[model samples]
Target: MVMENEEVSFADTVFGFWEDSQVHSVNSSNSSNDEEENYDDEEETFCTKEKNKAFWEEQGQLLQATLCRTSSIETKVRHATKEALGELNASERRCICGQLEVAKAKSCCRNCLDRDIRDRLLSLGFNCYISKSKWNNSPGTPSGEHTYLEVIDTSNSKRGEVKVVIELSFRAEFEMARANEEYNQLIMKLPEVFVGKGERLRVLVKILCSAAKKCMKEKNIHLAPWRKQKYMLAKWLGTYDRSTMETLPRAYTNRPQKPKTSMLTYDLLEKIPGLHCTTAVEVV
Candidate 1:
């Protein structure tokens, strides 16, 4: 009985040593895995920080370039204005027909207004076409649908070419509504006109109001600096405003077009053979 008890005690000691060795091995493996995980996390964090820093640095460089370009443009405009002012007669500042007050009270002739706008845009390095037929609506479609000017950027070849459809209005309330309607129609028709052409289109609504303050107050409309859409509405006291001309290029350059969508029709669906419609009224 004593020898049996001694053997059982010896067996228990061997089993306990084996169990302790197994536990020590597991703990060492766990510590190594924890260190690996911590090292990987720190590496990933360093990479993320480096990427964010590079992105912000690129953005800062772009902003600085834009500011330098804007400053250069302002200097050019100042010089141009000085030269233009030197050439203008006192009489030219007033109306040409000795009806300066009358012209101010009532808007000038469309031809005169268009000519002045074209001249200013040309000075700003834009190629302008007056009463351009390229922007006319389809024949017999609408008489009132027309664009006043088709302007293109002529200065920056690296920026690609930009096409702008400008509509001018002389009347206060009537012109604003007309401009909005025209812009909406142009937005709808642009995709069809420029399909596969890879060209971008922008619309500008230029309203000339005799009483700018009264008109703006009565209409309760404010011009937004920028919108998500490719069109802009601007009110000018006369043929052109310096601020408007300066900001106009940004409207079209580097601006992406809105996504195109097709209007579903029964004829379109009929093009697909073996397709059947269950109901008399179709739902898309």
Candidate 2:
């Protein structure tokens, strides 16, 4: 009977030890799992932060490089464009379209402004043309038409005619609603007036589109089709037609004040004998 009691106590001790060991093993396993999970989370967060920083830095570098590049032709065109914009804006001609108010509200008198600039560029002896890009709605962006200026440089005969595209509203092209701060800053780096070679503009378009993609991804927003690189490049680099209308004579640009007995504004009295000026000259 003593042997039996000893055996039973020994069995109880063994079971207790086994139970405690199992509990400890489970706790250790849970601790290891928790540590691994925390490590993974931290690593992932760090990677994401580093990726975002690198993307913005890369974009800034690309933009700066593209903007810094200039050729003699590009510089001349840029200067002429800036001067034209300044003078045109200073003397903003109201749209004389039938619906003046509607035209002004819609395009802010863009027709006259564009025409005036084109004329000025032509007078400046640049092979300027009003180019129109039209695309059909396919698997890509929607069908639309865009009008902008272009200058063809034939000075580099060895390399052939170089096309320098101009965008009066360059910055607005890539603007997005609800865009992140980084994306907006990149957009701001673009000049309000962009005058560059086709290759330079193409590179800029790619950079902006990629940055836009990252920004929208971070915000969990779907990137639009038009914002894609291909679509944006199609604006200036794609197939288009150039309207090579004849520019007026430069002499016509400079009209003299009327002689003492002549017309001041138009040659109405001279051209049309039926029209006559007032007997008394009244300066208003």
Candidate 3:
């Protein structure tokens, strides 16, 4: 009996010890798993933060580059505008086409106008070239009243582009022609005016040529023959779709729409007898 009891007690004690050890092992495993889980969570959070930071950095760089480019372009445009204004200030006024303003009479003339226009165009960094022969006066036409100017397009040399001659002729065409002739003669007399590289005579010549052509075109008018009369009636006309160009390489067609005709219709000085007018007698 004693031995059986002792054996039973020993077995119970061993079983109890085994159960305690298993419980401890389970607790240790759970603690280890929790630690690993916390570590993983921390690592994931760090990675997400790093990715977000890198993305924002890249975006910032892109934004900075965009702003820099915009600023540079704006600066260039501002500089160009200022330079053009400066040239304008230096230019002397002359009666190229407009009525001779008495205020500018002594300061302005054909020579001054030509130089001012050329200088303004050149300051903008354009390559100017003039043709060998200048534009001629076309009498008895819309263009008859304007001075002509032609300029070469150095920007698009591949297209062999030439600026349309501008004509300025609101005032008197004859007066403009005489002034131009005098100016040309004066320029020809000055070797430094057109033959020197330092003076940029080539560029000036081109600018002048182009200006002359444009002025001519602007002053050009279409004239129609009067009934049985040798003289023709004049009317202003245009070839461009718009007053100012919005885009380059203008679309041109040989068959263009004609401008609307303008004429005064005289219908007996009165529309239908004015319902019996009151008569006043003049005493002789």
Q: Judged by TM-score, which candidate is best?
A: 2
Instruction: Give the candidate order by descending lDDT.
Output: 2, 1, 3
Q: The CA-based lDDT of model 1 is what?
A: 0.40
Checking candidate 1 for backbone clashes, the offending pairs are none
Shift of residue 238 alpha carbon in model 1, Å: 30
**Model 3 C-alpha lDDT per residue in residues 1-284, reported as the tens digit of each score:** 45544555777889899999999999999999999999999999999768745644544444334323323323443344345435544543334444453224234454334444444444565432222222223453223222222343434557564343322221222123523332333233222211122113223333333333433444462223221011111111222221211122211122344766444664543767655656898999
lDDT for 217 in candidate 1 is: 42
Candidate 1 residue 114 C-alpha distance from true site, Å = 11
Better lDDT candidate (2, 3): 2
Find the candidate with the highest lDDT and give its number: 2
Q: Write the per-residue lDDT of candidate 2 for residues 1-284, one digit (tens) a residue.
A: 45644555777889999999999999999999999999999999999999899989999998998899899989999999999877655552444443343222224455555666788888899988889898888796877778888999998789998999989889999999889999998898889889999998988998899999999999999999988987888889888999867443222122353556534666786679998687897889
Each prediction's whole-model lDDT (CA): 0.40, 0.82, 0.38
Give per-residue CA lDDT, model 1, range 157-224, as digits (tens): 88676444344441222223423332333233222111010121111122112122223443466532
The candidates, ranked best first by TM-score, are: 2, 1, 3
Give the lowest summed-lDDT range of ten residues in model 3. 227-236
Q: Decide which is better by lDDT, 1 or 2.
A: 2
Runs in model 1 lying further than 4 Å from the true structure: 1-12, 66-119, 122-284
